[model samples]
Target: MGEMRAAVLFLWIQCTSGWMHPKCQIYDSGEDLGHFLKWTCNYLPRHAEHYTAACEDVTAIEEDLLGLPPNINTFCISMANGQNRSMSLGFFSQFQDLEYLYIDGCFTQILPTGNIHLPNLQHMYLIVKWGMGSGCCNCHIGPHTFRNLVNLCDLTIQGYRLTAMAPDVFHGMTQLQRFIISEPCVEDLSEILCRIMNIKSLIELKIKAPEIQTLNQSNCSILNTKESMKPVFNNLASADFSFGEIPHIEEGALAWLQNLTGLSGAFSQEVLLRLPLSGIQQIQYFSCSGSNEIDIERICNVVFLLSIKKIHLANANMRSLSMSSVELCTGLEYMYLGGLGSIHPSPHLKWNFITSLKNLNRLNIDFLRDKNPEICSFQKQPITWLTKLTLLINIQILFAKQFSCLVTLQYLDLTQNLISNIEDFAFMGLTNLESLDITQNKITQINANTFFGLHSLTWLDLRNNPLIHNIEAMSFTHLTSLKQVFLGQVNNPLTEPVIKLNLTLIFGGILSQLTHLYISSAMRPKGYMGQRVQAG
Candidate 1:
């Protein structure tokens, strides 16, 4: 009993000593300290030696931030109601151990003074929300304001109404690797891009200045120019620019980056029309999004360096794909094309490009309306390599032998296709298919042979249909590996009010592997609206 009392006394002494520091005070009672500024500081979890501080709703900026922990490593300040104070200062140097800093609020100026410096800081985020305090500009950051941050590696500055920024604002950041900027009012982006030319250690760079109307050779010439004895950027691997519908991009403007591999952004037709002739190469993954109708035949005449492995086009109208368009990119493994408003139909080409690819694994084409009858036969060639496929076209019928060539397919989705009938042997050769989704269609019945050859199917979804009013016996006997099924009805006022299917008859087959079943909008004789069953 004496030893236990001694141990308890020792722990109490340690706790008291730790909290006795001037910076580690506790203020959980919300008592006013008689000061206009309100802030708090505490030790971070698992980092008993470090502290984080935050101040919110600040209305003023003084020369020094007093009454807070002086050695904090992380600091965040939000001045949503700032009074647009401008004073030349070096106030942030007090946090000698500061590593991360975040500043957010609406103001006319942020860090406009050049005296601020934090040599130990590695990351900084500055967000200036849209405001009309001055009604002239949201925020105006000065040049060379952060030249003293020698150890800064990652920096992000996002403001839509930034009007003034010096060309040499990013001068002393030698170790900078990732830089992101989303200033839309800066029309002359070349000035900013020129400042980062000397950052040889940069790996990822992204800019979204939509107001820049043109991207020409002169705007990007400094990137290829030599500073000391060699090119400025030697380690840049990824660069994406979203310069909102620029009408022109001079050839060779972006071809200088020899080590770049991944590129993504939105470009105009004038740029994509000249991409093949732009001389840019070495890109392996490319993703583009736009609303313009792009002539894909011209861009796919010759493979871009023949090193492309994935091409994702989101909302870009890529019209009429031919075998030669995709066959040239021999290393492609995944292709995703989707657009909701694209109306140009592809001339139903025999999708030989799919079977010709030995490395292709996934293909998704969504919302590209094709009213052609031949578009239903996706696998005209013998396709035994693709593992996943998705088609959301307006196909009305699943004819016999339609998917017979997809013997190795594992996952298939044909949702919202208006399919009304599935002939016998429609899925005969899909022996390895594991998951199937046919939701939001017009399928009215489930024949015995509708899923005859999907012996390995595990999950089936048939929700939001007109109504499954008929079911031939043994409709699910062939799905030996089935585990989950979704059967939901989409109410139609024109259809007669009646309970179409009996649950016992649908589950009469040998469904020993079934574990979960979902049924919605089901009008049962017992008045149960929806039912969900879980089995062993």
Candidate 2:
């Protein structure tokens, strides 16, 4: 082999390390990415067939026949960032292995201006936006022209301005399994998405029109989506039904969302009501985001939630959910319940709500203080402190001691509370306590041996307070595992000799084991003496 050819082959070996050979250490081009690409394809044309061109914004991948390897697998041209005078499109068509294509940004001359027929192509992503008229104005993938990619499996397009998607736009991808179309509101996604069922093998369909706003073009007053709903998919597992603001949603008529494990969109009571819960036995994720009145009760009735592992009911008017059984959803994992501005987080209103989530590893209960007047009321103790700290909340009274379930509790937050002093044995039951935070509170003095038996305690917070003074030497002696202690506000006693901080108890003894300590500016070690009190 020639020296240059050998060098290229070696570069290819480096480029496909994990994919080609586990032991081979290929070359590292460092800052020169173009050099790496040139050397790689030059030496290993056979191996180059595996380089998926799924993210090439042609404008950014300016190549004039120099980068095309005959056997390339994927060629995704996502050009959403800048102008597209063919960032490099003038010469990238030669890569025969292109499969998944994801293009974004403006299009000038950098677009596939002709019928793109790459046999190995499985996924095609074409995102066209306002990038029209410069040089991109004349480029085209005309009706039924690019349908020759029969082996395509997945396709995604975002922000393309072509008004119509011919009936056979995706007619040739026989092996297609997943297809997605994301575009601006100016063009209808239904134009491209409605024909997916033709690919028989299509199992996953995603229509993410995040910034696209749909306007009833035909009548301007009413919505006519029937043209895109007739074809039913038997294998679709996930779908994305999102757009800007939904002007109108047809109730009791979502015929297309019957057998899905995941669903997201501007849905109303009807969509959540008739959802085929019986067929979706493995639903782990659910989102009802957007300004919609979701019938929390009707939705809870979808017994399939019993199979749900994680649920996101964000941005909806969902009041209360009564999930009262460990057997109800044994596989339940995580729950994010903070969309209802009026929904308050309280176990008392309905503690039976999540008791059944046996496998629940994480739970976030967020209540809008602006919506729930009750949250604004300053009570003597933290409102929702569950005794069974088996759950995690960062408030006052609802601490571990309040519940038997807290045995598994690892993190405890006591910020901005009425906790004045570290009560003796306050942490006695917290056998698993790893970190403790008492920040933004009124902690005057840490009582003697305050952390009596918390041998596993590592982090402590005593910041943002007023009366903190005199750290008793024996206070944290039992905390052998204590690594970093936050006492930045500890009354500096080094200044006043008459009222010196009993450093003999702190530094001279066991407390010396502390590696990190924070002290305040007011009290000195020599003259530290003052009326320290934890203000409520």
lDDT of each: 0.62, 0.48
TM-score of each: 0.69, 0.55
Q: Candidate 2 overall Cα lDDT vs. reference?
A: 0.48
Please provide, for model 1 over 206-225, each residue's C-alpha lDDT reduced to its tens digit, 9 standing for 90 to 100.
Answer: 77776776654435343343
What digit string (tens of lDDT, one per residue) describes model 2 on residues 1-536?
75664322322333433223222112222212233234222232223325533233234455312333445443433443455554433243566545445444554433332555556656555555334433222223334444556566876655543343344445556677876665433445444445454566777776656444342222211123334344556667676455554444333223444444554555466545544522333454666565565544554554344355566656534344444422444455665555545443333334454455555665555442221112212233322322222222223332223322344545666565555545566555566667777777767777665666566778887788766766676676677788788875555333433434565465345465777876555443444455342311
lDDT (C-alpha) at residue 458 in model 1: 92
Alpha-carbon shift of residue 487 in model 2 (angstroms): 11
Clashes of 1: 0
Error of 2 at 161 (Å): 4.6
User: Of the candidates shown, which would achieve the greatest TM-score relative to the real structure?
Assistant: 1
